[model samples]
Target: MASIAVYSVKGGVGKTTLAVNLAWCAATISRRETLLWDLDPANGSGFLLGVEAKKKRAAQSVFTADEAPEKLIRKTAFDNLSLLPADESIRTLGRQLGSIGKKKRLAKLTETLAKDYDRIIFDCPPVLNELSAQVMRAADLVIVPLPPSPLSARAFETVVEEVKGSGRKHPPILPVLSMLDMRRTLHKQAREANPKWPAIPLASAIEQCAVTQQPVGAIAPRSAGARAFAQLWTAIERKLAAKK
Candidate 1:
């Protein structure tokens, strides 16, 4: 199974939204048994899936023998999709990871889950610490969502450096332009600069994900937002295949 991490060094870049939507694309469009693993404390991924983790402190326990992730993992209403939700307890994950003194602990856990899943998407927190380090080691491909802004370039570079410095052979990074609105000059210019990069437009359908508790594709399959995610997933699949 391939593990994909949707991460950013800056917050409010739509990392969780990307993770959830891509997970839906993988499961519903690609027909892959996908797991959306929320490593962020906010648990936005679960909220988007219309599920919430009951054990408030159990999220951090999955890294050790203290908790079994299989028990915590809950199936979503969408077919072929499941969620390993996060809670506020994950905020201390960096400290817990450092104390354990085991590098690649997250990677080991992902390996165990590989037997049951075709795709594992991590909704990583927007931080540059041990938790992010562990995610870098675990992820096969790191997807960075960059909202159209001048500061986005710096954030993208920061993520590149983090992933590169994570391990000897780090996972490849894919930068995606999120919340893009071509009608705006800045957004149009940003797209022009990164013409090859996949772009998810700023649409009511995408924003309605929170209100509807469903992916854009599931709710409005004909919408541009849904098409963008589907195309991006297809591109990701091709990238994975090429790597193999």
Candidate 2:
């Protein structure tokens, strides 16, 4: 299975939105068995997909080898899609992983899940630490979502360095602009400067993801936000295929 991580050191960039929506597209549209793994303590992926964690701090067990991930993975309402939800217990994961000193432990666990899932989408935490290092080692492609701002550009650069400095061959990164409003001059200029970078326009459908707890694609398939996600998923598929 191919592991795709929707990650960014900067938070509030719609990272979780991209992760959940793309996983939905992969499962519902591409017909791939997808696992949306929530590595963030906030549990955004689980909340968005309407899956609840059965036990507190259960997610960290997988990383610690105390419990098999398969036992903790919960099926979502969507077909061919499942979730390994996270909880507050993950807050100490960086320290725990550092103590273990098995850099590839997460990668090995991902390999074990390959027998079941065709794709694993990680909703990563917004932090610079050992957890990020582990994700860098496991992911095949990294998707970094940025907004139309100078800070976002710097965050993009930091993400690039973080991925490359993982002490291994780095994964390819695709930077996407999120919450873009073409009416704004800043957004327009950002888009013009990097025409190749996919942008998700500001839309109510996407914002409602928190309230509706469903991907924009599942709620409004023809909406601009949904279309953007579909197109992005296509690009991700191409990147993974080329890697193979």
Candidate 3:
């Protein structure tokens, strides 16, 4: 299975939204058996999917060799899609993972789930810690969402440096421009500076997903937000294909 992580060192960059919508596209559009794993302690991904942030066991269970991740998997309303929700216990995940003393434990966990899933997407926390390091080690592709700002650009540089410092073969990073407000001069300038970067426009339709508790593709398939996510997923597929 292809393990894709929607992550950024900086928060509030639409990382959870991208992860939820992309997993929806993978399950509904591409018809892949997809697992959306929420690694953030806040559990925004499960909330977006209308699933509560409750897990079957303690946070440590996820990294423990004796525990089976399947037991924690919760089926979503959509077919071919499942969610591994996060809980309050995960607030201490960085410590939990550090105590395991295994850098590649998360990668090994994904390997065990590969037989059951065609694609695994992680909605990761916005932190550079042991947990983040573990996710980077496991992911085949790391999708970094950046808002239109110089700080975002600098954050991307930091992400690149972190991957380089991992001391292992790292996954390819795809920088996506999220929440792009075309009317703003700064946003326009940012887009022009990185024309090749795929962008998700800041629109009411995209924000409506929070109220509707569904993906844009499911709620407003013809909308620009949905089209952007669809196109993004297509690009992701092409990148994964080329990697193989």
Candidate 4:
């Protein structure tokens, strides 16, 4: 199974949205048994899928021998898609990872789940802590969403530098230009500068996913936002194929 992480050093770049929609695409479009693992403390991924995390135990239990991670897996309304929801308890994940002292704990966990899933997407929190390190170690591909801004560009550079400094087997990083507003001159310039980068336009339909509590593809399959996500997923598939 291939593990993909939607991560960013900076927040509010639509990381969770990408993770949710991509997971949906993988499941519905590609017909893969996909798992969306929400590592963000806010649990936005779960919220989007209309699944609340039934946290019967602490977050650490997922990594411990006491509880099997499968026990926490919750089926979503969509077929071939399941969600491993996150809770507020995940805020302490960095500390817990540090205490475990296992550099590839997350990797190992994903490996165990590989038997059941064709694709596992991690909706990671925006932090450069031990948890992020573990995520890098685990992921086959890291998808970074950058909004059209100079600061976002700088943040992407920081993420690249941090990944290089991690000194682990590096995963292929796909930088996507998200929340693109073509009307903005700067956004147009940014897109023109990086013609190869996939972009998700800033559309009301994309934002409405939160209110609809569904992926854009499911809510409005023919909408621009949904098409953008589909194209992004197609690009991701090509990248993964080329890697193999």
Candidate 5:
């Protein structure tokens, strides 16, 4: 199975949105047995996907104590898409992980679920703390959603440096531009200036996720945003397949 983390140091860069939509595409469109694991305490992925995730058992339970992966994983409304929900208790996960050596905790937990999933996408917390380090260690590919701004670029650099610093045989870092409005001059210029930027346009349909509570592709498959997400999933699949 391929483990992917949708992560960003800066919050509100559309990381959760990318995680939800991409996992949906991977499961529904690509037919992969995908699991979207919410590691963020905020529960943004759960909210966006319309999964309340109010269960007493959570992802942190698997790490804080000992719990089987199947015991914690909850099936979502979509076929082939399951969720390992996050409870508010996750706020203390960093502390718990610290006690167990952050680098290996997440990797070890994920190793248990590898046989059950073809793709596991972590909707990670927005910090470079112990928890983030653990996510990096566990992930096969890290997708960083970057807004088109100078600070975002700098943050992107930091993410690259962090993965490189890990010195793992395989470091997962895939950067994608998110929430881009082509109508805005800055967004247009940023795209033009950086010809190689994998910029996913900010489409009206994507923004409608707040009201629709569904994946962009499911809400409006022919929309521009849906197409962009589909293309992004294709890129991700190719990258993972090439590794195998």
Candidate 6:
């Protein structure tokens, strides 16, 4: 199974949104057995999937014992898609990881679930802490979401540097521009400015995660956001296919 982590050095760049939509697209459209692992403390991906994991069982349980992640793997409302929802307790995952001698604990944990899944998508947090390091080591491909802002560009570069310096078997980093509103003058300028940028157009449907409580592709298959997600998924698929 191929593991992909959607991450960023900065927050609010639509990392969780990309994780949710891409996993949904892979499962529903590509017919792949996919698992979305929510590693963010905010648990926004869980909220989008209509699962309440805030006060309940935390992702911390997974590290405490061998069965926590297995038990936490909950099937979503969508077919061929499953979720390892995040609990606020995951905020302490960095501390927990530091206590263990296993440098690749996350990678080993994913191995046990490999047989049951075809693709594992991690909705990673936005820092370079121990937890992020573990996720980076576990991922076969790292998908970094960036905004159109100059600051986002810098943050993207920082993530690239961190991955390069990690000393682990790093994966290919795919950078995507998220939440791009082409209607804005700055957005238009950014696009024209970076002519070779691999971007998906921004749309309101992408933000409907809060209201619809579902991934964009599932709720509005014909929406512009859904079409862009489909195209992004195709590109990702091509990359993975070429690697094989």
Better of 1 and 4 by lDDT: 1
Candidate 2 wrong stretches, greater than 4 Å: none
- Show where candidate 3 strays beyond 4 Å: 53-57
Candidate 6 wrong stretches, greater than 4 Å:
54-57
Residue-level lDDT tens digits of model 6 in 154-188: 99889998787667567888888777788888878
Give per-residue lDDT, candidate 2, residue 29. Answer: 92
TM-score of every model? 0.98, 0.98, 0.96, 0.97, 0.94, 0.94
**lDDT by residue for model 5 over 77-166, one digit each (tens)?**
899999888878888888788887645877877887888889999999888778887787888888999888888988889888777766
Positional deviation of 224 in candidate 3, in angstroms?
0.2
Query: Which runs in model 4 stand beyond 4 Å of their true positions?
Result: none
- For candidate 1, write residues 10-32 as lDDT tens digits: 99988888999999999999999
Off by over 4 Å in 5: none
- Residue 98, model 3: Cα distance from true site in angstroms: 1.8
Error of 6 at 184 (Å): 2.4
By TM-score, the better pick of 2 and 6 is 2
Compared with the true structure, what per-residue lDDT tens digits does model 2 show for residues 1-244?
A: 8999999999999999999999999999999999999999999999998899978778889888889999989999999999999999999999899998998888999999999999999999999999999999999999999999999999999999999998668999999999999999999999999999988989999998999999999899999999999999999999999999
Worst 10 residues of 5 by lDDT: 52-61
Q: Which pairs clash (backbone N, Cα, C closer than 3 Å) in model 1?
A: none
lDDT by candidate, in order shown: 0.93, 0.93, 0.90, 0.91, 0.84, 0.84
